[model samples]
Target: MNPTWNAIRSGLERGVIELRQTFTTAQDLWGYLFPAVVLLVVMTVMRDSEVPGTGFSLGAMALPSVLGMNVAYGGLVNIAQHLAVEREDGTLLRAKAVPGGMLGYLVGKIVGIAGAVLVSLVLVLVPGMFLFDGLALTGVGTWLGLLGVVALGLVATMPIGAALGSLFPNARSIGLLFLPIIGLIAISGIFYPVTSYPEWIQWIAQAFPIYWLGLGMRSALLPEALVAAEIGESWRHLETLAALGAWAVVGLAVAPIVLRRMARRESGSSVAARREKALQRVA
Candidate 1:
């Protein structure tokens, strides 16, 4: 037990190292930076509109949601996609061979991804405060709620990410995997309002974690934005909390099963054969 715990710690430390290495890699930075630029451009184009009450500007209303979306994209989607590639390349197998390897590796990733999200929030907030005229962080309660939403959002999404990583085990397949999620985000009112969508589509969006995270953010940092909603007060908060909690529960339960199956299937020769086949197919 002690050895396993130590191994977990070591894997976590190694994961952090891996994440830092990724930042230094030119391709990784380029991939993330391009989308960030696009988001900034779009936000700049959309910042002139007025938010409901509280005199908050459109930038202020949109800031929290954008932050929520970025965290989801960067933390969950990015991590999962990268892990899939790594797993296919036997990176996970290598880690599993070390002491407390898998646990440590996962812990390190969770911490690293959380750090990445915090950095992203800061990058967005600093410019947001200056460029936008009406921005505020009213009270401690609101701030706490924001923290809660971020924390909960990570917990809910990470397991699903791990499950996806374990299930798809290759970069090409993983790229294909992200299309559905991206589409969901579009339909979930990230870039637009959910009300604009049909009832069934709204229901589908509500079933997913991203929408609930956005709703929780809209509830927390942008409380005034919630007033225009048709639902009653207690129900909305309860609904947001319930949906996120339920997804977290289900994802957490399923992640281990998927991971165990992946572990069982992993073999050095099989990985080599797959890589060779992929290369051949490409050629």
Candidate 2:
């Protein structure tokens, strides 16, 4: 095997071990459930009205969005923050001393995040079925499409997260970046349709992967629901597939450069300094 692949495998193994140790802890479970619960409550409360022209209940409209949000949180923010923190805290350096360590770390993270996302999905979908009465899944095609959307969306978004983690290389900086992330999520049709935003904001939102994820998800889960809305007609599965592919290409292209630079900058001394700095901040 290639050295990079071997390193990645090693990293993944370590990441998995760490995840298994931490998985299902109160914090992890809470992280998975809290947003799901909020989404459930909002949808249940809003079921009475048509979301604009769509005769679909708010529950139906929100289900796909909730799922998309889970993907975003896990594949993007969570991956980015955790990687950056680890890089700063010396864990990444410790792994780097071993062959295939980086690979193992990332693979483990992906597996862990995927696991958490699955848990969150069940939490959202189970209650959504009863609470929303809005889940009207059509056929095997919908299931396949939903899977395609999730997988493709993760591919498109996770690289950006990885790139950001590599670029920032510090937890404090990563946390600061969340401010803009929040704004992007708000405008990106995760909560409301992108068309609901002004023309300029709509254009800006289209540039992000979250919008594509939401659009792809809506295409999967609410294909018929689209018939009643304005942008609904534009929610083409082919376009979603194409957009996700394009984003994945871009993310893959850009992320490695950042990671390479980050690796070059990394040193044991820097990690120790970062740890000390972090401790000072906490104190």
Per-model TM values vs. the true structure: 0.88, 0.90
Q: Against the unseen true structure, what C-alpha lDDT does each candidate score?
A: 0.73, 0.75
- Measured on C-alpha atoms, candidate 1 has an lDDT of 0.73
- Residue-by-residue lDDT tens digits, candidate 2, 1-283: 7888776666566657766766648887677667877878887777786677667776677788778777876778878888888898787787667676666666877777766676777788777766665455768988898888888878888888888888784887888777887888788876666677788997787777777787777777775656455354567667677877998999889987877678767898899888888889899
Model 1: CA > 4 A from native: 50-59, 223-226, 229-235
**Residue-by-residue lDDT tens digits, candidate 1, 56-174:** 55555566678778767765677787677777788878877876677777777787777777767767766766666544467888789888988888888888888887777577777
Tell me the spans in candidate 2 whose CA falls farther than 4 Å from its real position: 1-19, 223-225, 230-232
